[model samples]
Target chain A: MTKTFDIVFALWPRCAQLDFLGAYEVFAHLPGANLRLASEHGGDLTGALGLPLRDVEKLSDIERCDLLFVGGTADMSAATTPGMLQQLRRLGEDARYVTSICTGSLILGQAGLLRGRRSATHWAFLDQLAQYGAIPDPARTVRDGKFWSGGGVTACVDFALELMADIEDPTYAQMIQLYIEYNPAPPFGSGHPSTAPAEVVEALRARFGEKLGKIGGVVPTTALT
Target chain B: MTKTFDIVFALWPRCAQLDFLGAYEVFAHLPGANLRLASEHGGDLTGALGLPLRDVEKLSDIERCDLLFVGGTADMSAATTPGMLQQLRRLGEDARYVTSICTGSLILGQAGLLRGRRSATHWAFLDQLAQYGAIPDPARTVRDGKFWSGGGVTACVDFALELMADIEDPTYAQMIQLYIEYNPAPPFGSGHPSTAPAEVVEALRARFGEKLGKIGGVVPTTALT
Candidate 1:
């Protein structure tokens, strides 16, 4: 019998839904993949822009998992409570693979999971990774050791595909891609700062910069020496 | 003040989550957009692969909407109930635009909304569109009058961008694309049958074909003459 891979997603209120949902779509198809959603408080939680996620398991209740994933939130403070960080540290240390998408990397970093490791996050917040002792990689997805991260909201799909390839095989990942019909055909070419129009990128950078500024920075309490 | 667009998603149990979630991610960002998730029975609904969607409104309670959207399901019978089709027909007629992703066109077609119109759906089910009087278009996204459809699951993002461009403008849609960082970089080229390895395509076709066969096809009770 195939070994069941217990995969848990640690989510919080107002988290970007697509950050994990995109990956969830891909990972749910993997053979023997057992998926669960957990939050700091558990129960029904509203995600970004009023998306509802129900019956979430409390972070404290999950003893361990094969893979632990987290998605970014607009308000990082909600996910950075000391209790939440401690729980994340516990889960991350025991998981075979630790992963995140979008600003989720920042949460992982705050938990001291990304110290001295290369990671990726939303392009707007890439520079902030250093605050948590993580080396920020500008790639859409980055993998170092057993820690994996993806950039921005939609990068979850790409990150999951790559991780799936690593966990299973390229053929299996490719099959999942085909099953979801993930052939993307974007109508515009402004997904990244480098490729987006200068004006568009600058405007978004300013807007997101302010949001991040309000959240400030939390010291990585578990930073490695 | 900008006019609020009442965008309603008509969903059912087992409907592909990404089919609506991808589009929802985009639509949620639209200026003056009011998004609502409604199911045949309302209340908490479990979607594809056990994704819980909470606080969903019942279709019978929604009077009308600016745009009515639907996503595909693994088992079409669940979405083809007479009561559900009647509600869809009512909502689609009043909405300014009628849209779908993946096999959702099948639902709209059965609601008597796609007769004699060009539409697109998942590659595997493209041929089935003719049964409901829809002229199947092989494009990734197709727009006929105010009826828009996208191919397969991942096409939801592309379709939404196109619809957004129409609802607002190209510049606004491009800005949203950048915000979501939707520049997709699929790790595999097997998202479609045409580009996938022949063996992989054959295998998936066989599998999906069996599932579709088991669900069988429902006669378009409301198909236009």
Candidate 2:
């Protein structure tokens, strides 16, 4: 009999749609995968880019899940709410694997889950993880025990594929890769800070650095390292 | 002044979310992009994998757009409706570029927009494009005049980046690419039939071939070559 895996995605207002959507597409294709999207309040919410997401399940209603996933959000205040963090801490304890994409690791950290664990986040916010006792790793995808994390938005796709291999098998994951035609032919070589032009990197740093400060301010006094 | 490009995505029930979401993430960052999502009827609709999409604009209400995009769908029936085709034809006529990801080319073909055009679609459906007078191009992204098409689902990201380079400039597109951190590192190299294991390819072909037949059944008599 095929074993059904209940995978829950914890989302919030202004969450980066692609951060979770990329992984959602991958896990949705997995045989016996039961994917659910949830939020603190549930129902409708607007993505960071104003995309409307509807029919989200409430976090309080879900009892437990095989995997608990969270994606990045532009607004840190909504993600760091007391109720949201409480749910994450509760769900993360029971989930077979606790995972995240981009700055989502920061949320996991805020939930008091990433302390002393090596995790990954967006290239721009890698250093911020240490504030929550996370040993930030620069790899696009990092796996330390059951806490699996992906870097940036697009890396969620890669992270999910790798997680599938761990949860199921490598062959199954490779098949999903072919199905999605994920042979990425990036038009340019400027995806990372290391590869992007110095001027472009500097410009984005100035923009994202301010957002980083906002994220830092939201971290609770008790959660800080 | 940054010239605002009014881009419209033509969505339908069962449309693959990732097919357009990948491109949407890239285009949403474009300096002057005005993106909108539309369906035959304005309201909420379920995506191919049961993801809820809300506040979709009505197709008939949109007079014209700078670019028209359609993504692949699991159920092609919703895509070939007379009203849907009519709107696509009307929008494609005035749009600066008519674009699609994955099997969306098949929908464009039914709308009579792909007649005698070189295009691309999902690898599994490439040959089927010939029935609609489209010359199937194996390349991941194809552009013939103002009609741009991407191969399979994930190719939409590459297609959008290339289109950005055309609409704005390479540097601008590269900047957007960096913002998304689109450095794709596929955990495996089985994205295409040529690279995937023969057994895996055969399994998917058998599955997708049944879907291809359903697509063929829906092609209008006048549209077929």
Candidate 3:
């Protein structure tokens, strides 16, 4: 019998709910994969929209895993925390695959795992990858060797299936996709910045520019909270 | 200024995470929308993928809301639970709009909310809507009169934006869509039964047929554990 594939997601404050939960569900449903949530503090972590994740393992306690999954958050402050960066770096160094979804690439980049690697992240923050010596690509998902990153929040679904396909097979990915009914139909047809009206994009920039700008470089850990 | 719109989601065991969470995040971010999760028992409800939802209000405590949302789970078990159905009926009756995601429509159907209405649900179980006198349409998202239903887990995003557009304006919905970067690109093209391979669909039917059959008719509330 094959050994179980261990997958761990680094949980943090204000993480996007879908970024980790979406991919976590896909892997949890897959046969022979051990799934867990890891965080600085082990219990009752909150993500966006007041979503609570229970029974998370302390990050320092987990020695290793087959895959280290990092997800992005609405606030980038956690990514720049010295302790968070160090933990991500340590986990990335040992994991068989270091993967991320949405702005999670920012965390990976800050950890030095994406140094000289091509990556993809939320389109609005793709250029910031350069600050950490990573090449940013605008694709929905990008893979460079063992480093995998996805675009924005919804891109986590794509990243999950693609990673599943790579590790298991397209057949396994297809089956899970069907079971979950992965069909997506955006009613407004404007999910991408390019597809959205210029005024709408400007409005979002005005709304979130300050928070997003903080992601371009790692801020002092003390600056957070 | 318009009165704050009230929205409530019926929470239950095994509820699909994306079903309500996807839509909830969008609405929670929208201004003037009061969002709350209401479950039969309330307090620290666990859903699919072991995702914990915080601060869910007790269903009996919520008298009315502008919109009543219900989400689906892997099995149809929760939909047939008498207590859940009664709460849904009570809430749906008072709400201006009754909405659901994935097989959540099954719960609405069981509560008699979908009686004589056109609805959409998870593709695999669409035909079962007939058991509750509902017209099942395969559209990604369907809005008939005051009832709105989405096709599957991922369809919640579309259902959310559409509902947002209806309550607010298209531009507001577009702005939120851009903020979340809702651009969806499924790595595998098979998100629907029509697009997935026959073998994959067959495998799913074989795996889930037993749990699914119980949903065709209302099971005794006592039957649920």
Q: By DockQ, who's the top model here?
A: 1
Instruction: State the DockQ, from 0 to 1, for candidate 2.
Output: 0.73
Interface RMSD of every predicted model, in angstroms? 1.1, 1.1, 1.6
Error of 1 at A213 (Å): 4.6
Off by over 4 Å in 3: A211-225, B1-3, B207-225
Which segments of model 1 are wrong by more than 4 Å?
A: A205-225, B206-209, B212-225
Candidate 1 C-alpha lDDT tens digits along B1-225: 188999999988888899999999999977799999998899889987889888999999999999999998877777888888999999999899999998899889888889999999988778889988999999999999989999999999999999999998787778778878887888889999889998877666555556654222433344332
Kindly list the per-residue Cα lDDT of model 3 for residues A1-225, writing each as its tens digit.
157888989988777777887788688766678887888777877776677666778888888888999988767675557777777888889998999988888778877788899999887778878877999999999999999889888788888899999988888788788767788878776778889988887777776666655433343323221
The alpha-carbon deviation from the true structure for residue A52 of candidate 1, after best TM-score superposition, in angstroms, is 1.7
- Over B69-184, each residue of candidate 2 has an lDDT whose tens digit, in order, gives 99997677888888899999999999999999998998999888999999999877787888888899999999999999999889999999999999878877777777777888
Q: Clashes in candidate 1: how many?
A: 0
Chain A TM-score values for every predicted structure, listed in order? 0.92, 0.93, 0.91
Which digits, one per residue and each the tens of the lDDT, describe model 1 over residues A59-155? 8999899999989887767788888888889999999999999889989988888989999988767888998899999999999999999998999
Rank the models by TM-score, top first: 1, 2, 3
Instruction: For candidate 2, write residues A1-225 as lDDT tens digits.
Output: 188899999988988989999999999977788999999999998898878989999999999999999999767788888889999999999999999998899899988999999999987778889888999999999999999999888999999999998988887788788888888888889888889998777666655556555422343334332
